[model samples]
Target: MDLRQLSPTLAVSPQILPDEVPALAAAGFKVLVNNRPDEEIGAEIDHEVMAQAAASAGMGYHYLPFHPGQVTPQLITDFIAATTGRGPVIAYCRSGHRCTVLWALSQAGKRPEPEILEVAAGAGYDLTPVRPLIASLASRRG
Candidate 1:
C-alpha cells in the first residue's frame, strides 16, 4: 500500500488487500473509506471483505464507490459527512488519484486554493486540471 498522507487526518492509497487492514488500524486510522466500486474488484477483495477486515481490526468502514468522472455533488457531500470527526481516515481507490481529487474538492470552502493544491502536489497528485472546479466550488461557498 502506497499510503499518501494528504493531511493530518486523511491519507489516500491505491487498492489495499484485506490482510492489510490490521496494519492500517495499527497505523491509527479509525476509518477506512473505499472509493473503488464493487464491479471494479474481485470478490476476494471486494468491499464486503474489506469491511469485514476493518471490523475485525477495529476500524470503521464506509463504501462510497464511484468512478473518477462519476463523482456527484452528493458523493462529495457524503464524503465530508463520513469523514469529518471520524478520526484519521485512509481512503483508497485504484490509484489513489480519485481519492485525492475527492479530498481536494471537499476542502473547497474550508481551505485556501493554493494550500489545497500544494498539499495534493506534495502527495504526488496534480490538481491543476481540477483547479477550476475547486475554484467554482469555493466561490459558491462565499
Candidate 2:
C-alpha cells in the first residue's frame, strides 16, 4: 500500500488488501474509507472482505464509492464527516486518484487554496482540473 499522508489526520492510498488491515491499524488509522465500488475492482476484494478486515482490526469502515469524474457534493460532505471523525483515516480508490480528488474537494471550504493544492501536489495529485470548482466551493462557504 502506497499510503500518502496528506494531513496528520488524513491519508489516501490505492486499493488495500485485506491482509494490510493490521498495518493500517498499527499506523494509527482509526477509519477506512472505500471510494471504489466493487464493480470497478471486481469481487476479488469486495467491501465485505475489507469491512471484515477493518472490523477485526478495530477500525471503522465507510463505503462512499463514486465513479471517476462523477463525484457529488453529498459525497464530499460525507467524506468530510468521515475523515473528521475518529481519524487518522485512510481513504482508497483505484490508484487513489478519486480519493485524493475528493479529499481536495472536501477541504475546499475549510482550508486555503494554496495549502490544499500544495498538499495534493505533494501527494502526487494535480488539482488544476478542479481548481476552479474548489475555488467556487470556497467562495460559497466564505
Candidate 3:
C-alpha cells in the first residue's frame, strides 16, 4: 500500500488488500474507506472482505462505491462524518483518483479551493475536471 497523506486525518491509496489491514493498523489509520465500485475490480477486494479484515484489526470500515460522475451529498456527508475528528483514515480506489476526488469534495466548505486543489495535485490527482462541482459544493456552504 503506497499510501499518501492528503491531510493529517486523511490518506489516499491506489488499492489495499485484506492482508494489508495489519499494516494499516500499524500506520494508525482508524478508518478504512473503500471508494472503488465492485465491478471495476475483481471480487477479491470487495467490501465484505475488507470490512471483515478491518473489523478484525479493530478499525472502522465504510464502503461508499463511487463511480465517475456519480458522487452525491450523502456520500460526502457519510465520509466526512466517518473521518472528521477521528484518527487517521486511508481511502482507496482503483488508482486513488476517485478517492481523492471524494476527499476533496468532502472538504468543500472546510477547505478553500486553492488548498483543496493544491492538496489533490500534491497527491498526483488533478481536480481541474471537477472545478464546477467544487464551486457548487463550496457555494452551498453559504
Task: Flag the better candidate by lDDT, 1 or 3.
Answer: 1
lDDT agreement with native, every candidate:
0.93, 0.90, 0.88
Per-residue accuracy of model 3 over 45-142 as CA lDDT, tens digit each:
88888899999999999998998889888988887887787789998988899888888888787788999999999999999999888889999984
Can you write out model 1's per-residue Cα lDDT over 34-121, one digit (the tens) per residue? 9999999899989899999999999999999978688889999988987889999999999898899999999998899999999999
Write candidate 2's Cα lDDT for 63-94 as tens digits.
Answer: 99978778888999899888995969999988
Backbone clashes in model 1, listed as residue pairs: none
Pairs that clash in candidate 3: none
In model 3, what lDDT does residue 10 have?
Answer: 91
Residue-pair clashes per candidate = 0, 0, 0
Where model 2 places Cα greater than 4 Å from the true spot, the runs are: none
Best by lDDT: 1
Ranking of models by TM-score: 1, 2, 3
Best by TM-score, which number?
Answer: 1
The positional error of residue 44 in candidate 1, measured at the CA in angstroms, is: 1.0
Q: Residue 133 in candidate 1 has what lDDT?
A: 92
